[model samples]
Target: MRQSLRSPQQHCPARRQPLPVRNRVHRAWPVAGVAALAVITAGAFTTLAGLLVGPLHREFGWSRSTIGLASSVNMVLYGLTAPFAAALMDRFGMRRVVGTALALVAFGALWTTVMTAPWQFVLAWGVLVGAGCGSMALAFAATVTQRWFVRRRGLVTGVLTAAGVFGQFAFLPLLSRVVERFAWRTAALTLVVAVTVVLPLVLLLLRDHPADVGVRAYGAGEFTARPASAPGAARRTVRALLRSARTGPFWLLAATFAICGASTNGVMWTHFTPAAHDHGMPATVASSLLAMIGVFNVVGAVASGRLTDRFDPRRLLAAYFALRGLTLLALPLLMTATAGPPMVTFVVLFGLLDVATVPPTLALCRELYGGDSAIVFGWVGAAHQLGAGIAAFAGGAARDAFGSYDPLWVGVGALCGAGALLALTVVRPSRT
Candidate 1:
């Protein structure tokens, strides 16, 4: 009450009260919370693209490689856009960046309904949609970490990371059914409508930092006064940031994230829907499988976050890559009967492992790289997308040739094992 500072919102009462425990989670309205909302939006759109893959293939008879390319471009552009998003968020308030991104995403998804060819797909789903989601995405994660939290960062991150998974889990089935009954165009348009619903939610509730509303953070449950950053720190020029990006941890984080992209979105998002269909699974059933994996992605990612808090992040990284590699190797065989117990088991196991690597990767970025963490994560995630982009094309090619995803499973698993070794050798930080 003794001091006043400029903030994004002036409407809040000077004496803000604590949120009741149940509502406290909402009160945090924290970056993690915003990230969760963005995750749902991103996941829905991402999985919507996958759900459409099967129907689009059936409608146009485009080769897998061709369809994969569209998703490839999306992932590539998505990853490529990450660092800029982080930088932009750093420069502006999270509210402007995320809300604008959501609006763009909804526009892109809606526009996809009218596409007549590959180029149209590329313009809508690949470029605009991907970039939009990528921008706001872990924005929540990065923003929350840097501002509202100093402890339990990994746990908060896990919840946010898990949001995308839940979105995929919850949205894919509904989308698949829409595709089954209406058409691929309907699915895309439906997403446009769905994303429209989240826009107001984002605009009204989201804020860049707790200070913006004349309040201290929620969970810390104490109102000690401190500026979120040093004066002028938030407005630092890009040159200062680029200079920092060249540090060692920058490359390490980007490399690990590239591996992350290759292992997850590269194969799963682009191929899984069609692969499930190819194996004789109905679209609805396949969607259920995808959702089941999302359920486990939440569980696994949360567990990884907890472990990240307790263990050496690098060791945890190694284990995640190795175990994920093993899972990839086993999947082609296990996911065979789309309607059986094996399929269920595969979904459960794979989903659990799906985004589990994320918390560790992001946690390590913050722990090792410090102030440059989000931008570092951005570059690393770009690598992840780059890998996914390559694998997206390759997975399609292997399937077209061998008439099975078996070869890709083995190859991707090997890549994951190599990634595990890389995680092992990730150098530790010395005292800065």
Candidate 2:
């Protein structure tokens, strides 16, 4: 078995220590750089998809089902790759993996500018973007949690995740306006430029660990023994996480996170525009509302991040699911384009729980999996994407079938209730 890191709050060997113990602090630059890259990349791809949805639909005459499938493919792959990517990071290093992933994203985005058919678009933009992002997704999140100061792990995760939501919120609208002003192809090319611009800064600023620079982990009172793996090579870190699968608490965490995915990005992100359109809301207006969802998602995610350090992650997850379900169920009753109580009520409540589960879910992964926490969380993240894939496609398919998203709204609400049960009853101290 691979060796675990030194126990929490432990210090490194004497010769390896950077400066006097008192001078060691987790440098902020590397993690900040990673977070910045995450925000821009996630924001760019999500916005690009939104802007292209109209153009692709108009150009190809493909049904919404066809378009939704592409996103589903992308999301599933994105989540599935996370564990492997984390494994790879453990082997190689973040600098190479992240840089390569960014390059792939850039290649995929630019390649889409030349596609003449829907499948071509799917393969290039959907698959490649998913692949690129898959390698980059929760790897960054894991690194932030593992490498940052312990007391601030929750806060760090929240802030980093918020960068992703902000990307969705801010960039989609900006790109929407850009697509309005320019062709969709031009809008896509712009993203390629943006990713390329960020790559250099990442290479220059990011180091996989503080130890590389002759320092202990950020705020770690003690450090663990380093593993024997090469500085940068991909391995089956996911297999490491499977050890926890035999237990109940891990299952509870997986199930709850799957619901987390289904409830938020799976349904809300995928179906919001079409659902709003069902009620006669224009697509762009619906998009703005979704972007608004990103805003509150940022808030909820940040708050949850702070909360994870103090509260039982299970309680936080259970509460998030209960609240999310209630809000989703209320949507058919509450949502509208106009500025009114039901609409505002829907926005405020649902938005609060949008991404609130992330911190607690991640914290619980560490609790349950211990030394293999990063890899375990990667698999859990994979479960989230799988739920996202199914729900994303299902939401679109439901819209295509029944002409509204009411059934999915109800179904997701029910799943959330199930998730709450799993969180409250199944989660135990050693199980995580």
Candidate 3:
């Protein structure tokens, strides 16, 4: 009777011992830092296409449309390779895939320095660099957030997306100055050096899963085991595309993202500097304006990420698209020979809206698809690149034929309005 009356705690005193303390700073944050660095480095190459168009035209007498064709190839490959790369990441791990991508970029940039023909440009810049950049695209960010974070996922996604855009735009002024002061070959070589420096850092720091470092994903209550590496990465990629293609949301997302790519990468990035030149603006000044958009983009993307965590993502996308459409429609009036206050305002507003679409779009992918969101996003990203490629070529051709980019601007603006409407139609799946 005395023993029975004793408390259960007396029988198992070990159970009352304090649990092991977790680290004050999670390893996920450091890993995310490294990933962002890699993304930024990869993104540094994107604007090179725009910056080189004038220099190449002056030296080689290649038509603007020809250089635009190469850029179109680059954009298309950059988009198409994303889904496959995401699958490859799942199978091989992030470090290896990203490192390999960096190597390809370095090689491609080096190759561009020596190429003499249009096909060589197509092969080096269009194929190799495009594929390399694609491997390190927005899909990589989605994968990092999916695997390493359970909390602040939206914020991290936004930061990483912004990192890529930052790399693309921020380096423009520097590269433009380099091209003006040195040769285009020197600018390409500079890119090669940047990529080579980043490759080792990625291999040394990037881990495939949180489990590799003996920590649970950030905010997870218990340690989660790493999943076994699945084989047939190509098959997995195809299967994902096939399954997602059957769904209504996938098509809507693809269509809107395509418009996103068209409006941003295809028209603006590929043509903005040349168009500014067409208006008598100095190349360096135009590049600086583009860089300004890059700087503010970081602020916009991170803020959008924070908002994504709190607000309805669909509404956020709808608003972003609408605002962006209005801005693009007004861009023609702002293009002058110099950067005025009105031009600066346009740059700031456009920069803020530049990649803001990414975070909410990723959010919707995860919310709708659950475990397969990253893969689904890859397919969606492909659509984005396709739209961008078409727009890039079309913008160049329009300028060559009609002697102005005004019509292209107005066309893309209308398409963005369509994207806004599409964003509203994406409803969450109903529960049983």
C-alpha root-mean-square deviation, each candidate: 6.0, 7.5, 4.3
Mark the regions of model 3 whose C-alpha exceeds 4 Å error after superposition: 1-22
| RMSD (CA, angstroms), candidate 3 | 4.3
lDDT of 3 by residue, 249-293 (tens): 999999999999999999989999998888999999999999999
Which candidate would rank higher by TM-score, 2 or 3? 3
Between 1 and 3, whose TM-score is larger?
Answer: 3
lDDT of 2 by residue, 201-257 (tens): 878877777666665665677764555655433345635665878877777787888
Backbone clash pairs for candidate 3 read: none
Looking at model 1, report the run of 10 residues with the lowest lDDT sum. 229-238
For residues 1-432, could you state the per-residue lDDT of candidate 1 as single tens digits?
Answer: 323453423555443444354455544555456567777888788887677666777788777678878888888887777777777776666677788888888878777877778888888888998898788566457666667776677888788888877886788878888878888888777777777777777777777776676666655666645445333433343443566466665666667667777878888877777787777777687778778888888899889889888988888888888888888888878765446777677677777778888888887777676777777676677788898888888888888898987888888888888888888777777766
Residue 311 Cα positional deviation in candidate 3, in Å, after optimal superposition: 1.3
Please, what is the whole-model Cα lDDT of each candidate in the order they appear? 0.76, 0.75, 0.92
Which rank order by TM-score, best down to worst?
3, 2, 1
* Ordering by lDDT: 3, 1, 2
Please identify model 1 stretches exceeding 4 Å from their true place.
1-26, 218-247
| Positional deviation of residue 69's Cα in model 3 after best superposition, in angstroms | 1.0
